[model samples]
Target: MWVYFLLVIAILAWGAHLAWRWKQARDFAPQLLALRQQEGELPPSVSQKEFTDLYLRAEGPRAGTYVYACAAFMTVTLAPVSSLFNSVWTAIWQATGSDPVFEVGTFIHTFSFFLAVMGLTILILAIAMRRYYALMPPNLRQVIRHLKDAHS
Candidate 1:
C-alpha cells in the first residue's frame, strides 16, 4: 500500500513537472516573439503556418526535455521503491498466484501505463500552451521570436 501510494505521488509529481515546463515554454515564447517585433523583423501575430513552423522547431525540443525529465524521475524514484518493497510484493505474488503470467504482465502493464499516462499528460499541456499562444498579443509574440533568433 505504501509503495503504491509513493508511486502515485511520483506520478502526480511527473504531471506537475510537465505542466511547469509547458508553462515555462508558453511564457517564454511570447516574450521572445515580442522582443522580435520590437526589433521590427518578426510580426506580433504570426500566420498559422508561421506559428506552426515555430512551434515545430521550438516546442519539439522543449517537450522532449519534459518527457525525459519525467522518465528519469520515475526511474530514480521507483528503483529504490521497487528494491525495498520487493519482498512484500513477492510474498503477495506467491500467496495469491493471481495469474500465471502476471510476472511478465506486471512489468509490461506498469511500464506501459506509466509511459502512456505521462505522454498524454504532456500532450495535453502542449495543446493548452499552444492555444494560449494564439491568444497572445502579436507584438509580444514577435519579441519572443527575435530573442530566440538572437540566442541561436
Candidate 2:
C-alpha cells in the first residue's frame, strides 16, 4: 500500500537525520564547554549564577529542539515497526486457530503519530527562535552605529 511505502521512506529519513544530529551534538560539545568556561570570567556585576541562567535561557530552546527532533524520529519510526510486530502476531494467532487477544497496537500507532506531530511543532518553534537570535536586529543596529561613527 502507498501508506506502507511512505512509512518506509519516513523511517529511513528519520534514521539518517538522527545520525546526523548525533554527530553534530558530539562536535558541539567542546565548543559549548569553552563558552561555559568563558562565562566564568565575567565581571563582578554578573554573578556566575546570573551568567549561567542567561546562558541557559539563550541555549535552552536550541537544546529542546534537538531533544524534540530525536523524539520525533523515534515516534515516527516506531509506530510502523510496532505495526509489523502486530501483523506477525496476528498471522501466528491465525495459524494456531486461537482466539485473538485484544490489540492495542492501532491505538499505540495513532498515539505515537500524535506525539510525533507535537515534536515537530516544538522543533519548528525552536528553529524559528534560533534563527531570530542568529539575525539579532539589535546587534546589527549596533554594528551600523559603529560604521556610521567611523565614517563621520
Candidate 3:
C-alpha cells in the first residue's frame, strides 16, 4: 500500500515538473522572439506565429545550469542499473560452471561524469539555432529567408 502511494506521488511530481517546463517555455517565447528581433537575428517579414515558433523551438526558459543538473541527475540515477545488470550476469555465468565473464570495476562515478559531459554536449548542439533552422521544413525555411531578405 505504501509503495503504491509512493508511486502515485512520484507520477504526480513528474507530471508537475513537465507542466512547469512547458509553461516556462510558452511564457518565454515572446521575450525570446523580441530579443532575437532586437539583435537582428529574426527575419523581418516573419509573422508572430512563425517567429514565436522558431524562438520557442530554439531556446526554452530554463537556464543552462538547469540542463546540466538534469543531465547529472539522470546519469547518477542510471549508473547503478548498469552495475546491477553486470553483477547479475556474472553470477549466472559462475553458476553455469563458467568463469566470470568480465572483471567488474567501480566505474560508476567516472561513467556518470562522462555521460553528463556527453549529454550536455548533445543538448547544446540540439539547441543551436543554425542546426535547428537547418532541420526545418522547406516552407518554413523559405519564409525565414524571405524575412531575412525583407530586413536587409
Worst 10 residues of 2 by lDDT: 41-50
In angstroms, give how far residue 79 of model 3 lies from its true place.
Answer: 26
TM-score list, all predictions: 0.37, 0.30, 0.39
Q: Give the TM-score of candidate 2.
A: 0.30
Q: How high a TM-score does candidate 3 get?
A: 0.39
Deviation from native of the Cα of residue 125 in model 1, angstroms: 21
Q: What order do you get sorting by lDDT, best first?
A: 1, 3, 2
Alpha carbon lDDT at 25, candidate 1: 60
**Residue 25 Cα positional deviation in candidate 1, in Å, after optimal superposition:** 1.3
**Scored by CA lDDT, what does every candidate get?**
0.57, 0.52, 0.57
Residues 1-152, candidate 3: write the lDDT tens digits.
57645655665566567668767877776675576678877754556776656555455443433454454454444447456656675676567776433334436534654565577556655565444456544443454555577767
- The residue-by-residue lDDT of candidate 2 on 1-152, one tens digit each, is 67866866776676576667655655554454455346642223333443334344333344444555655554565567566656765676567675534333556545754576576567766776677667543332343343334434
Off by over 4 Å in 3: 60-152
| Of candidates 3 and 2, the better by lDDT | 3
C-alpha root-mean-square deviation, candidate 3 = 8.8
